[model samples]
Target: MTRRPRNSAPEPPAHFAAADLPVRDCVELAAGLASYARRYGLAHVEVSGPPELGELIEEFGLDEVHFVDSHRRPAVDIEATPRTWRCGQRGLRCLSDQLIDAAHAPPGRVATASTLAEGTVLRFTRHNRLGDALGIVTGLEHYCRDNAVASVAVTGSPALAEVVEVFACERVRYAPLSDRAVSGDAIFARSSWSLPWLDRFHHSVSDTYGGRVRHCVTPLLLRQEPERPEREDVVYCQFDARSGTALPLRSARRLLSQVAAHGDVHVLGGPDTQYYLGHDVTYVRAELPEMVARLLSCRLFIGCDSGLGHLAGCLAVPGLIVSTDDFETTWSFFRNYASLSVIPLAAAELLLS
Candidate 1:
């Protein structure tokens, strides 16, 4: 049996903050609610799985609610995988697991078209995470185009602005993000999506203090400009991530080296260009603009799960993302799917086919 120090205080179970979440993130939001229950002396989470898995979670006092048995997936397209969990289905699965404790405990704020006014200018007040910003802007871009709505965004990021500049309709404007009153009568909207696991995270902040999740269909608008006909066969790779969520550098280098044997490899961020000096690769000290240019020119982008990969998706750049869990598939995997645990190079090879 596990033991604590004789005079030690009893430690409460670990938890997550589940506020406004995208349907895909319902999985994490579910578990977070469970955590809340345990801490408050409500019901402890009841879980079902193999005995070995049960024992593992018993140690953490959790049910291990995440993508399990992913390694068993046939080394190919995710569609071939039997799990029908993606997007809203993740919400259903989490619900089936009885993760949400209170009945509609957290009031959800979903900004569907019914909630937004037409032809009135709306400005979002919150700005964080290039990835979520990308998803939000992409949704807004399409929303404005389809409905002829005038919308605005408040962000300090020129890189994000560049994305809006490239895709958003003329009716949408990029207002500055900080240190000023929100000009005009601004109705708010927020980007809602799932959490990355462990120390891994990309925020899903709302425009309000705890924002509302806006719903809109985000399209792949990467129809190339004829003037940009000279697209090159370069594969872009990035080993960087926020929240310590990136692949180890040595593993990254090895993967890139293999990808390089097929064609030219462009590394996005790493310690130094000198580190991979001998490899058939070009290491770029990437800025948003530079990254955009490279993304536009390359045949594909490959990287650990990160926001830049989301940026690539925003620009309609095809990407292959290596992630620890299937959470991203529920929201964003950029059309390329690969698994972890079995070492993603094997998964990548299947995605390649």
Candidate 2:
């Protein structure tokens, strides 16, 4: 058997920016980006709102120097003539126009819009990992090597910065915001210009549940405290598994039994074996906040990488994040949360130590 090499050649850096959207979106985006920018220092940002939005930007030592007024174009104005997808609402039609216009704009300005009948003139590359994201950064670096971007402002995660550094991006910047900013009432009215872009981005992305429970609940969990535990002896466990992985039932049960030796262990989310952890271990399907609260009340959070782990960071709860693979990526995203101690699945036997 052949072993794979660790970290090949570094890739180029990408341009990161944060836009001023609804407070909720802005804060979430900021928290994710701040970690990246702080680590890599990629700066060159374009914000869509006023300077006050800088509060979040400064948290990560990132500066927001440029601002674009929000544009509120009607959805019908941007509708596709042939109509690739059905336009259920008039608002969507208006958004179609904005995307078309943005995509057609000249270079220097970032445009995210639907491809028109003329086809997409803008070059696009998919980045699903650090390498891929770095590839995109490399292309951008070659394009603007001499005239380096003032900086890269990220509103995502630090893992994104590692990709940027691979591209040799030295001027990285970040924006950080607390969970309150994400759930607080809108600080500023929706800008007239923002209306059109928001609609177009929403439509182009095809995000169905803009106002649904998943989106609303995750952010809420970041802000609110979990409900008080019903029973002191009931230990809540949040088993967060990454996209492609599983926890062995026997091993997990053994681990749970050890952790909650004196308490009833309750497992929530991901996998059915949680149901078979014996009479002392119960399972429940609750919303993100409820799940988070339950986990907080419990003695420990034992699972693989997942949104639940990320949520634990936001709650500042002491827990363990299990990652049998991709330890670097997982650590990059959750390190800033300050409450998580990541352990690879191979090291489970040493969990208590």
Candidate 3:
């Protein structure tokens, strides 16, 4: 993605002053909306995850909040029954509820492509890549014009922001992080599709932290672990990249072996290691709280600069993020609560120290 020239003297709006909070999964987006709403005195806010809203409520002291389950409507009828609940299906429902709420809830000035109204809608981008960035901007333009959004705040890549301005919106604001401070105790690392780079980065971090680091992933892996014989010293978790095509499975296997050789290795998402030397690793699938507890208990967090890294940051855990240099310049891990060290692909091995 080409970098757009920074607009040094973009005209500031005179009378623009309403807050539209659209909830998404990204912590930065959530924090941005919360800040916007509090600053502007918004009466109603809509978001995807209820848990995220809980965080907002705690921060902002929400007095008039409504819970809209955009994902799953708890089946009261099935609550008493002993049937297994499909978590992924439930997650889908939560996403659906959020989308529906945004679509039907009063058509506020804030808008997404699917939900827009006349006024200024803050459209947030979902991914870090270029194509998705363009799509988000294009979608926001359509959504703003249809919903009467006078302007749009294009939040995401700098490249996408440039494309959004061409559509003649009222204004665009950038919320880039200027300074970040990572905790010395926490060292974060992860496996990217770039295998050689990930291996080198993993080693660097292990060396730096004296081979003491906690790997964090989603709670899905722990959910599958056996309940009996509860292990406390080293929590087992799995890293599931099954749904996505970009995950470096081969690199992950190699990194896993390196982790095991140095210290106790806990898998947080998946159990497959056939791609790299067929090494067997211990794993446990548990609830999100369990995963969170495990993460908070650790001093240093090492993972790919993905959602797990964000989660650790959200919990105020110090982290060392291993990512592409370009990736750090565009998308950062630190928001309001946590900070990280952005190590480029070339310097990943430095993280092991």
TM-score of each: 0.52, 0.36, 0.32
RMSD of each: 13.6, 20.6, 22.0
For model 3, what is the alpha-carbon lDDT of residue 282?
A: 60
lDDT digits (tens) for residues 325-344 of candidate 1? 45344234344222212225
List, residue by residue over 1-353, the lDDT tens digit for candidate 2.
96546544222122223343544334433332332222233353334443444555453333422233443332111111222211222232333233334435221222222221111111221122322222233322332222333442332344334444322344432234333222111111111112221122212222211111111111112223436676355545655333344566666666777666655666765454444455455667764335556666755566565545654554566777776545554554345556678777667646543
Regions more than 4 Å wrong, model 3: 1-247, 271-279, 329-331, 335-339
**Candidate 3's C-alpha lDDT?**
0.37
Q: lDDT of all the models against the reference? A: 0.45, 0.39, 0.37
**How many collisions per candidate?**
1, 34, 51
TM-score quality measure for candidate 2:
0.36
User: What does candidate 3's lDDT look like per residue over 165-212, in tens digits?
Assistant: 332333333344222322111111111211222122232232222322
Q: Highest TM-score among the candidates is held by which one?
A: 1
Candidate 2 Cα lDDT to native: 0.39
